[model samples]
Every structure is written in C-alpha cells, then in structure tokens.
Target chain A: MNPRRRRGIRGNTSIVESVRLTKIYGSGDISTVALNDVSFEIQRGEFVLIVGQSGSGKSTLLHMIGLLDKPTGGRILIDGIDATFLSDSDRSEVRRHKIGFIFQAFNLLADLTVVENVMLPMMMIGNGASSAMRGEAELVLGKVGLAKQVEKQANQLSGGQMQRVAVARALVNRPALVLGDEPTGNLDSKSSQDVINLMKELNRELKQTFVIVTHAREAFGNVDRTIVLKDGKIESIE
Target chain B: MDFRLVLATKLLLKRKGNFIASVTALVIGVMVILFNSLIFNGVAEGILRDLADYQFGHVLVSKNDGNFVNEDLQLISYVQTFSYVEAAAPRLGSIAWMNSTEGASLNEVDKIVIIGVDPLRDPKASLLYSTVNEGSFVASRGQLVLGSNVASDLKATVGTRVDVKMVTASGEDAIRQFVVVGISKSPGGLAFDDSAIMTVEDIREITGRERETDQILIKLTDRSFQNELKSRLSNAYAEENLNIQTLEEAGEETLAGIRSGIAFINLVGYFGLLSASFAIVTIMMLMVSNKTKDIGIIKSLGGKSTDVLIIFILQGLIIGSIAALSGFIVGSIVGLYLQSIEFSFGPGLVLEVVYDPVFTLNSSLFSVVLGTGAAVYPALRASKLQPIDAMQHS
Candidate 1:
C-alpha cells in the first residue's frame, strides 16, 4: 500500500486542499489578481512541484496552501481540517504542528549553529532545548548529512550545506507537509541539483509530502506530479 | 534555555554596536541618577547633623517668654530621668562687650553673645568639644571658649585675657576679666561662630542670677524619638509655661528648603532615566527593522507573534541588567572617592557624599523596568509583521 494513502482522515489522502482560491493585490482600478479561482490538492507523501512564469500565481498558491496568507475568496483544508477561517493563533498552531517552510534564501539565523537552526521548529512548538530535543535535532541533521557540521554557524556553510540545514530544520518537527519557495534559486546549477536530489531522497525515505514552487522545473526531475500555472490560472496538472 | 531567550541573546550579540550603544545610554542615565542621590542625601545629612549638634540638641526647652528658665536644675534632673534621655544640660545666654587687654586696642571692642554650659555635661548634649580647634572647652571660672571669628576680631588666642562688661541682674554695670581657653569653629553658618562659651557658674556670678538658665538642651538616644518625647515633655511641663521644640521645629525653614531641593534632584534623576528609555526605544526599533527577514524566518518556522515579542523584550532586559549593574558599581566607587576628598564651601563646611543601598537598588530596578517598557512598541511592531511581508522586505 502507498504511504500517501495510508495516513489522514480515514479515506482522505490529501495533505493540502485548495478550493476556488482567489487572491487580489489591491482594491479597485489598480487592483491585480494574483490567483484566480485556482483549485488543487496535494496527496499525502506526494512530491509535487508548482511551475509557472513570473506573476503567474505559483507562489501565491503556495502561500495559500501553507496558510501564510488569507485568500480573498475560498477555503483551504489541511489533513481534512478547514483552515481558511481559522483565527491567526489557530493558523499559527496549525503551521507549527502540520507544516514547515523552506525559503530560497535558506533564512538560517547566521549567528546560530547549524544544530540550533535545525532545532528552531521544535523550539517553536514549545519543546525547550532539552537533551531529548537536542538528540532529535541531531538525528535530523544526520539525515541531511550535516552531523559533522552541527556546531558550525549557519553562515559558515556553503549554499548546498545551508539548504541541507534548512531541510533538516523543516523536517525536525515531522510536519505533515513541507512547502518550499524557490529553494534552489540562490544556488549554482550543481548545488541546486544536489538540493533537489536530497529532497527527493528524503521524500522517498520518510514518505513526507513536499510542495515546491519554482521556475526551474527541469532541475526537479522524477517528481510525483507537476502543476503548471499561467495568467493566475492553472494551465495543466501533469 | 527557552529558544526565545537564546535567539534574543544571539541577535543582540550579532549587532554588537547597537547593543553597546543602548547599554551605554542606560549606564549614563543610571549613573546620573545615583550621583544625584549621593550628593543630595549627603548635603541633607550634613545640614541636619549641624542643627542637632551645634544649634539645637534633639530637643530644646525654653521659657515661653524671653525670661530665664528658673529652677533649671530641677528641669534638667527631670529630663535626665527618662531612659531615652542621653543627657541634659542647662545653658545661660547673655550679651556683653569684650576687648582683649593684651592687644593694642582702644576702639576694637566687639559685642558678643555668651553661652554658659557645664563642661562635663555639655559635651554629652552637644558637639562643642569637637568644634574646639585651638584649646579646650570652658572648664573653670573666668575661662571662656571664643568663636573663631570673635577670636580673630579681638586679635586673641588661647590664654588671651579679655575684659567683659555687662549689666548685672541688680541693674548695676559689672566688669570681669576672663582668659580665652579655646577657639571653636562653627559650620552651617550658626551663631556659635561669633559668640563665646563659658561655665554656667561663672555666667550666673557675672549676671547676679545665682540659679537661672536661658534654656536646657536635651539629647535623646535616637533622633527619631524627637516627636514622641516632645509631646510627653510638653504635657508634663504644661503648667510651667515652657516652650519645648524638636530640632526639626527649631530649623524648620532650612530643613524644608533642603527637602524641596532633594525632591527636585530626584525628579531630574528620573528624567535622566526617561531619556535613556528613549534611547532603548530607538535602538530596539532599529533592531526590528534590521531583523525583518529573521522575523519572517522565525514565523515561517512556526513562531507565534508572542514569541517574537518576547525575544525582543528579553533583549531589552539583558541590556538593562548589564547597564544597571555596571552603573551601580561605577557610581558607588565615585561616591566613595568624593566622600574621601574635602570639598569645602567655607571654613569647616564640607560636602558629604552618602551611599544608600536601598535607593541604588531601586534605581537599578527602575532602570530595568523602563528599558523593558521602552522596547514594547518596537517588539509589537515586529510581532505584528506578516511573514510574507517580512520575507519580501529588502
């Protein structure tokens, strides 16, 4: 049996569900629609990619799916729970427990050690820096091949290593879904390929769901599926 | 450790320049407050000491009118019976003309007030013995302790014989000769600096009033008992028509002025702390602006708005603690050094620096609270930041 269909609300396999989502930037004449009635679902444990041109709403959809922003019109469900109308605190709780994020900038606090950066999500979840939490963070870092560099400051790591640390941080809490926005945009071609490959390997090993927004679709080979966007609307799901 | 604390400390360390600047502001403000407290408290203490030691004892007893307090020995004996009464002494005050016989002086005679006291008991009731700079206090008949100024005016020193003329109680002019036994100095600009001290027996003999006293000065075990003792004495001596006054009542105007000055100094000190609070506000605001991306990152890592707020607040607390501790140590050292040096306004008048531990501790705690308060707005701004907006912020 596929692990993607193994977890969630009984028969439901979708980790993220967006229905008729619309996000408009401004009010009247100057207003621009960033997402126009876009609907999509990312199954549990599925490695998915959202590819689009500039201003094509790929990142907008990701933001809606991650619950980082509210949609002007529509609803979002995470693991079969209605997330669109949740209060800010509730949204934060959901984000803390069920989702993790990776940015193109890697966004690691430069002054903190690599292990400390990885421990951030657990810390946010109210698990203080206990020995058990430290062990868990170390175990995650080891999975990302950064066990040797756990004590090094985040800024000292190369682009690929930094992204690996970011990956470790995202997975340290064992979130139900992970969202990445241009995760490899700041890296060289080789480092970018290495990061994507690592994410693919992590997804296969842990059966973790991934939804990445990117323009470089070619680098993300062998993904479970690809959703393309154009003019703030879904063009295809392949 | 909580991650918020760890993050706050790391962020503060990352921006060493800003942290140092904020701490410097608080340090200066705290030091200013502490120094203000030291100088004002010292001045107040010195003035109060002078009033108690030289002008009035802890309490004073006099006749309601200007007449001499008759039967003063009985009054002194009664006052000394109280357990809290450290000592009591009778005093006789009179006006006379004195001229040094050994000096080349014809029109150099000076009019002065004479205060007669018992040599042995007076030292317990007052600081007369400590004020003597040249010779001893009056111990025998015809021996006088001259004020520094009076001695200077008469060209007299210890053992200089002077002739004193005054109207005796029988309405007849009487002249007497006395040798100056001591030269005493008076700080706080009291009348003692221009008068003479003699034994009460000699004063009564010259005035032809064998058993009369102008007033009785009483010293108490502790000055704080002045009010309670005053009330008791007032009731006990109501029929005698006596005027009983505490040291505070005798020098009310001077003490009130000093208290007002201290209040103003305290206001200015707190104002210094307020200015330092503004520095904290500015520094924290700049920190928020610089750490926009970091805020977004933390939020994306599932940090709550409250978490962000606490991180910045913790930063302020850390800065305040360090600065307050540093300022207290520096202020205490400087206060001690000032106390060691003699800063005189006039002869025998010097500035005193006092260090009150409770006051310093409260000032430090107040600084810490103000620092944390100053960071509120900036911390709120950081907490309210949208993750998307912050991540997009350049």
Candidate 2:
C-alpha cells in the first residue's frame, strides 16, 4: 500500500482501534486473562452491537473502549490519540469530553431532578459557562422527549422514563459517542423495543455514534453491524 | 460546579435525618465555643472591675527614706507639689486585739488598719468612702468605725463601746478605748471583714507615736497618667524609699491566673469542635460508600473527580454551617438566661455572673472556615474513587 494511502485507510477504518489489548485479573497461578489479545476497530458515527454469552469478554472490551479500564498490554487509539498512554486525569478528561455512557440500571442520581442531572456534566466540565447553557440543557432534554418531565425526581420516574432520562443526560453534553452496556436490560419487552427504536432514531437523526452491548437480538435490529466475542476473543464481525 | 453545589444542597435536603444529625453536631460545637467566650469575658470583667473599684486607687506612694515619719511627711509634700496627685492620706495597719467590756475574751485577733487621715481629704482620696455602706468616716477623735463583718463577729452594733489594743511602732502593746460610731464593708468584700477605722489623732494618741504613719494612699487626677505619676514621684522622692503600686500592677498576678483558666476553657471547647470534625468525616465516608454506584455513574457520564469531591464536601460544609449557627443561637440564649439569675456563694456573698456572650466577627468567621476545612479529607476520598472500581463496588 502507498504510505499516504495506508495512513488514510487506517484513519478511515476506525475512530477507535484496539491493538493487541490484553487484561489479566488476580495474581500468581490464579490469574485469569479477561481479554486475550483482543483487537478491533469501531468507525465513527457507526451504530454497532457487541453481543456475547456470559464470560465472553464483551463488557471488558467495552470498558477498555470507554477508557474506564486499563489494558495490561496493548494500545487503544481514540480518534488518533494514544489512549493507553494517557495519564489518569487525561484519560478521564477524554472520557468526559468525548464519550457518553448509559448503564443497564439507568444510573441516575436519586437526589437530583431530571433537569439538574442533565445540566450536571456541562456545569462540571469548566466553570464560567454562559446562562444560555441551561437553555441548551432544556433543549437537549426536550430532544430526548423529556421536556414535560424535566422537573421530576429521578427515583419518581418509571423504569422506561428513567432510562429515557439517562439517555437525555448522556446526549446533553454533546459527546462524540454514546456507549451503552445493555441499555435496555431492565426494561419490559415493549419498553425495551421502544428504547432501542429511540436509540436508533437518535443515531440516524443526530448522526451520533452508538455502541450498545445487548443479548436480545431484537434490540440489535436497527444496528448497522454486529460484533460477537467468545472466550475472551472476537469470534466474528458482520 | 454550581450545579454540583445545587445537587449537594438537594441531597442534603432529601436526607433530612442525616442532615439534622450533622447540623446538630455542629450546633453543639459552636455553642460550646460561645459558652467558653462568655464565661471568660464575665470572669475577666468581674476581676478587673473589683480591682479597679476596691483596692488600688490609680497609684500608691510611700517614702524613699524608709523612715516612717519622714516617708509620711515626704509623701504629703509630694502630694502637694505634684499637680496630678489628687489626695494623699496617711495609714498605719497592724494586728490589734479588740476586747468587749463584758469580758468574753473572744480570743479571735483582729488586724486593725489604724488609718491616720486628714478626714477632710481622706474620703475623697480613697475607695473606702465609696464602699462605706453603714457609717461615715471617723467624725471625731475618740470615735471609731468597724467593718460590718467585724461588728457582727463581736455582736457589737454601731454606737457600742469597744477596747482596741495595738502593737505600736515602738513594739509595745498599746490599749485605747473608743466608741464604734460607724459600720462598713470592704471593697468587693475580701476576707479582711474585721477592720477598724480611726482618725490620725486617735491612732497617734494610742500608739504614743508621733509624726509617723506606715503607708500613704495617693489618688491621681487621671488613672491613665499612673505611669507618669510613678516616674515623677520616684524621681522627686528619691531621698525616701517610696514604692508606687498602680492598680494595673497590683492585680497582674490574679489577672494572669484568670487568663490561664480562660485559655484552658477554650482548649476544652476546641476539643469538642475537633470531635465534631471527626463526626463529619465519619458521615462523609458513609455517604461516599452509600453512593458508590452513583459516583461511578457520574464519573462515566463526564463528571470530573473534582465534581464528586465538591458535591460531598459541599454537603459537609452546609451541614456544619447550619449546626454552628444553631449552636451560636442556643449558646447565647443559654448564657443570657444564666446571667439573668443571681447565684449565692454564701451568706452575704452573692455573685451576679454576667454572661454577655458575643460572637466576634473574627472568631465566628474562623469557626465557619474551620468547619468547612474539616471536610477536605472526605472530599479527597470521594475524588479518588475510580470509575471502574466504584462501578463494580457492591
């Protein structure tokens, strides 16, 4: 390949690329390898599903990609930045500025109202934001279809509503990507379908990238591609 | 972040039980500090006023000659010469035997301060006149005035006859008969409850002593000029061995001891506040542990480590401030209540403890700063929480 064309191909291949990532847990003879030389690429603005049976290293791979965990031996490049070599605070900043996360439990702060939770990230990034930031937060909340329930406390919301609120909070900061770990795990069948459809709609309408981990095939229906992991390694990508 | 503070405040509002407990602890701490200040202020004021009002009269002057007669003469001369000198009176104090005519032989010896005064200037010159509640200064040569406690001990009332025996300047026992025309109390009422007041002529007659007095009481025109008066008197009366005792100097030892006691009380109050800080640490640690999952989520959702730290610390400071303010209010009210009631030390010794407790701007501000400062450790703990580890925490 031409050196310039090779660089271009590598750049276009993925916004995030894991190169020979390995993680070991425990000590001495009891050590277990959670990710065995796992490597993959996730393109920008791509809606992808990472599916696997239990103990398949799927969540571990997602954590490394999210910059929530350190690789034992490997490199993770996020949009050309060498993420593995970043300082703890720098990595955290990268996570904060570039990635949005959704948890299976809809991890909303129980003490905060929906509006406050959505405004939290914007306020924390740096001090001295303009008054218009709040207006932006309300607009984002409205985008997530939570404008009417903006004042509701997190704990008071129904499960489906709470998940939607979490989605709003995630997108409110305008991060480059949304990373969800079984985002619909706690929802009923109908609610689960509704949430996945909303995620898909957001992905298309906002042109924001999404990486969701789910066991339910129906939840992955609108995803452009599916990546499967088996026994601490990528089994297939389709 | 402002939002973090708002969130912290909301959390505090929601957890009303914990919030109350934290505030209560802080209030107790603040009350202790205020109470300590009140007691110290009252005790200090009481001692100062008593010293100023009872014994030391701005300044005291004695002769530089060491000869009783010449010292008294020189003191009187200096008093007349110095413009600042208000009045100077001659006094002779000695242990004397006072016997009743009934001959009960009440062996209890009395110390008689045989005051040889120019009655014209003495009352105005000394604190004695102002403190004399029962009778006027010895009006005639043969008349005497007894301290109230002294009269009560002897079962003698004013207008009764008594024989007073004194060891004169010649070291011989001299006896004289006199009528107790007046009764009075000591200033601030020290233990010297039995004192006999007599004229300079009467004391001179009984002692067979002439032109001699043991001490000279000097009053100054302005108390603030005491230092200048002392220096001038010392220089002018260099021939006589006169020593000047200013009110500020006489009570230095007692005042120092009282100040040390005040310091000890404040130390105790500080210890209480320290324990309250420890209580805050415990509460913050509990809060961090309780909200582990939430912390993890916040971190993952672009929340900086500092944000988590701020939220927790803000909670602690808020609680501390509320508690400290409540304590201030409660302590002041209690101090006021105690001050209003009179407490008796013994018969005829009632003390009205003044409890005018106040929060000085500096002290109050320091307390608030300290309360907030104590939350740092808990905040650091919250900030050090790792996103992945906290997420995995049970």
Candidate 3:
C-alpha cells in the first residue's frame, strides 16, 4: 500500500531477467563453473520451474536470481532494476522489497515461533512489530494452513508444517518474485505433493511470479514455462 | 522490542549452558575486581584512621630543632582560637625505663616511650579515652595509662606501682613512682603499642622542664581542613621556628606503600577481566558457529550485515550487564560480611572492608565495555558470511 511499492509494481511486467549469468567456484586448474552464461527471463504473475540434474546449475541460477549470490559474469535484473552490480546493502534492500526465497531444508529459525519466522522479512524491512505486520503474518500463516501452529516453535513442527511456515514467511512481504530451490526436497512424497499444490494454489490466487528449481519436474504438472539446463548451460526453454 | 534484540535473546536462551557459563565468567571477573578494590580501601582506611585518631591528630606542630616547644600553654590557646580547630593539646615525648614493683620486689624492667598529655584537653584531641581496654584514662597527676604491650611487658596491671626513670633536661637522672590507672589498646600501629601516657604536669615535674612540651596536637572539626589549618599555622607561627605537618605528610611513606599495593591489586584485577574477556570471545565465536544457519536464514530474509552484527553485539551486552549487576550485588554483600569481621595484621593494625560507590560503578562499566569489545570479531565474522555459503554449511 506504500507509494514506493505501488510504483515498483506498476513499473515492469518482467519480474526477473538473467543475461549471460555465470558463476565459477575455486580457481586455476581446479576451478569449476557452477553456472555458465545462463540466460533467462521470468514475467510478472508467471509460475516457472528450473529443471536439471544435481550438478546442472539449477540452484546456482536460482541463487543468482534471488540476489542471494552474485554472478561472476553478466547481470541480473529484479523488477527491472540491475541487481548484479548492487552493493551488499543495496542487494539486501532489493531482496527485501522485490524477492522472497524458500530453501529445501525449510530453513526456519528453530528458536523463533512460526508467526515470528513469518514476520521476519517484514520486520527486517523496518516494519517493526506493528499490529498490521503481525496481522498480515497471521493471515499469511492461515493461508498456508498453519494457523494452529503459529505459536509453536519452528523446531517443534513436522517437515510439512515447517515448510508451510517457510511458505508463509516467503509470501508475508508479498514480493514481486518468489524463488524456491528444492523447497519440498526433504518432504515425503505426499507432503511434497501437498506443498507443490499449495504453492500452485497461492500462485493462482496471488498472481505473484514464482521461480522454482527442482529435480521432480513431473510433479509440477503444468507451469507457465520451464527452463532446462545441462552442465551449467541452458539447454532449452519450454 | 526490536527484532534484533528479540532474536538475540532467543538465540542466547537456546544455548542455556553457554550463556550461563559466559555470565559466570564475567561475574567472577567483576567480583574479583570489586573485592580487590574493597580490600585496598579497607587497608587504607584503617591506616588513615589509626594515624588520625591515635598517633598524629589532624595536625602536629613541633619545634623544628629543639626537644620541646616553650610556652606550650600559649601555643595551645592560640591554635584553639581557629574555628576549624576542635581542640589543641600539648604532649611531651620521652624515652624512659620502667620496672614493676609488686610485693616490694622488682619483677621485670622494660624500655618504653612515655607520652605526657593534658588530661582534660587530650581527651578532646584524641580517641585515647575510648581505647582504654581496662580501668580508665589518666585523671590525676600521679595516674598512669599503660599501652597493652607495655603493660604486658612490665607485668603491670591496674593499681600496680611502677617506677619510671628518665634523663632530665638538665642531663640529670630522675626517677618517679606512679600507679597504673588504665590499660589502653590502640591499634594505631607500633607507635602506640610500646608507650605509656600520663599528665603533662607529671612529666614536666619529673623531668624538671616546666612550661614546655614536645608537640601541640591539633584536632580539626573536619579532617578536610588539615591542610588549610597547617598552612594557616605555618603562617601564624613563622617566627617561632616550628615545624607544622599534616597527617598525610607525616604518614607519606606508609601511604605510598599502600598506594603501590593498590596499583598491584588493580593490575591483578585487570588480568582477571582480561581472562573473562577471552572466555567471552570464545563463547561468542562458538555461538556464531552454531548459529551459522540462522545467520544465513536472516540474511536470506533480507537482513543487512549490520543487523546480524547488532544481534550478536546485543547478546554480549545483555550478558555483560546482567553479570556486572549481579557481581556488584554479591560483592557488596560479601563486603558487608567482611566489615563485620575484624582482621588484625599484627599487635596494633586491624582492617575492615570499605566500599565506594563511584569505584564500584566504574568497575562495572569497564566490564561491560570489555564484554562488548570481546564480541566484535565474532560479530564481524557472522556479519560478513555469505548467505549461500552459510546456508550450505551443515
């Protein structure tokens, strides 16, 4: 509802754009290219998946797009702003305003309550613990089917429940883009299917762009697009 | 509450054992420092009290190059005229030999310093009357008050007749018999331990030195006026060839030694704080290692590096403040207990613990700064961690 956020939402249809992004690990003879000149674009309100094998740079591309890791070459743009050259503080600001991330391990701060975990992004963006932020967090948790577990410590939750808390946390800020790197990788098959269905449902309802990287391509059933990579290079886009 | 503080509290609570250990370390450090400071204060206070109450009154005025100051009554009257001077009394100091005669037989002979005081005026200028352990202070010309050690050495008691022998001012040997009236135990160091007190008139009559005394002891209404009174006395008696000294000036060497001892205690206390700081550093480093995943999660949630830094720093600060306050309370309780007990170093020196509020507050503040400083490196390391790398850490 803030003027700046409204301006951001109205500014661009392309939520994310990666142009020849490359990330290399190590150096000299032992150096390995984690991502090699990978290029992609994700539009607003699109549900997209990045599919590849274990070493195919799917997580790398997702990390770069989320602004959690910088590309060694090329550039990344989030909500039409060039993000690759942003300072660490500026990158954090961009990430706070424009992107949300969910990891395979759920990555909830175990010591915090589920509501607290969900309220973290909003608090980090200087919203404080205002009743509005708290209400929004509770609303998001309710949407993720975690209304009853909101007061429980994150560590006390089951994998499915913890992932639901993570989902609530990711969407609490209503970011323009949400990135997931194997979000359901550690869940049971039923739990995984349930989480994927929840994510699809939330995407349909919220119309926020979602970029997910995973090995279980068939589980997605249908998405707006899928970017396939092989050996750190983009092989195809469907 | 700020999210950083809330997260820091939760993080510290999550590791209860480490948190308690860190607090205990800092508490011990603060207690050690406070204990050392209190002991130093106690010893210094005991020494100064002994000097002011028994040996040196607040100011001592003596002849610069003679055994006695002539016209002592006039000098006493002149000194007492000052509003700050509570009382002025004359004292005559002489080395003498004493032997106790019980049953018409001399039991033991001892060499002693004899101090002659004005019976009425001396009581106002010194705590001699209160220090009498048995009988009472000298009230008449022949009455004698014996120090504890001198009384023990001479095998004398209240009502015992003792012969005191001394060389007169005219270089003639003189002897007089006196009955002991009191046994006084003044822990004003060795000076008062091997001495005896009697009426100034009695000493003058025995030594054939009438109307003269060794020193004029001046007690002040407040001890802080010692220097000002000394300066005024010096100026007033500039033509009298007198040496005027303040209590501090007279006890300079002993005070210097005590100062050195305090410095050493402060060094030891700082070393204790340094060791505690090291424990904090190690504990904070371990905390950062254990919370790497949390750091990554926070950063991934759009927390800046400064946010992570502030969280860790706040943890250290909270621990330090709690420990410091606990240590101060515990230390004060222990100091009060110590104040109830008496510690005697020798025949006439007893010490009781003392506490100063300003010193205690400064010590606690120092501990807080050290604790906060100890966390800087670990905080920086946590703040600088890359979100991706930290998330990958298992």
Number of the top-ranking candidate, with lDDT as the measure: 3
Task: Give candidates' CA RMSD values in order.
Answer: 3.9, 4.4, 3.4
What does the lDDT come to for candidate 2? Answer: 0.73
Q: Which of 2 and 3 is the better model by lDDT?
A: 3
In candidate 2, the second chain superimposes onto the true chain B with a TM-score of: 0.78
B154-182 per-residue lDDT for model 3 (tens digits): 88999998888988989998999899999
Clashes of 1: 0
Error of 3 at A203 (Å): 0.7
lDDT measured at residue A88 in model 2 versus the true structure, 0 to 100: 69
Q: Which scores higher on TM-score, 2 or 3?
A: 3
lDDT of each: 0.85, 0.73, 0.86
User: Which pairs of residues have clashing backbones in candidate 1?
Assistant: none
TM-score of 1: 0.90
How much is B144 displaced in model 3, in angstroms?
A: 3.0
Query: Predictions ranked by TM-score, top down?
Result: 3, 1, 2
Worst lDDT run of 10 residues, candidate 3 chain A, spans A1-10
> lDDT tens digits, residues A1-238, model 2?
0111122235574666788889888878999888888877788789999989998888888898898888898878766567887766777788777788888988888888888777777776754464666677789888777889888888999898889888887887777778898999999988888788888888888878898888886656767888888988889998
Indicate whether candidate 1 or candidate 3 has the larger TM-score: 3
> Candidate 1 lDDT, tens digit per residue, B25-89?
99889888888777777777777777778768889888887645457778778888888999888
Tens-digit lDDT track of model 2 for B272-314: 8778777777776777787787788778876678778888878
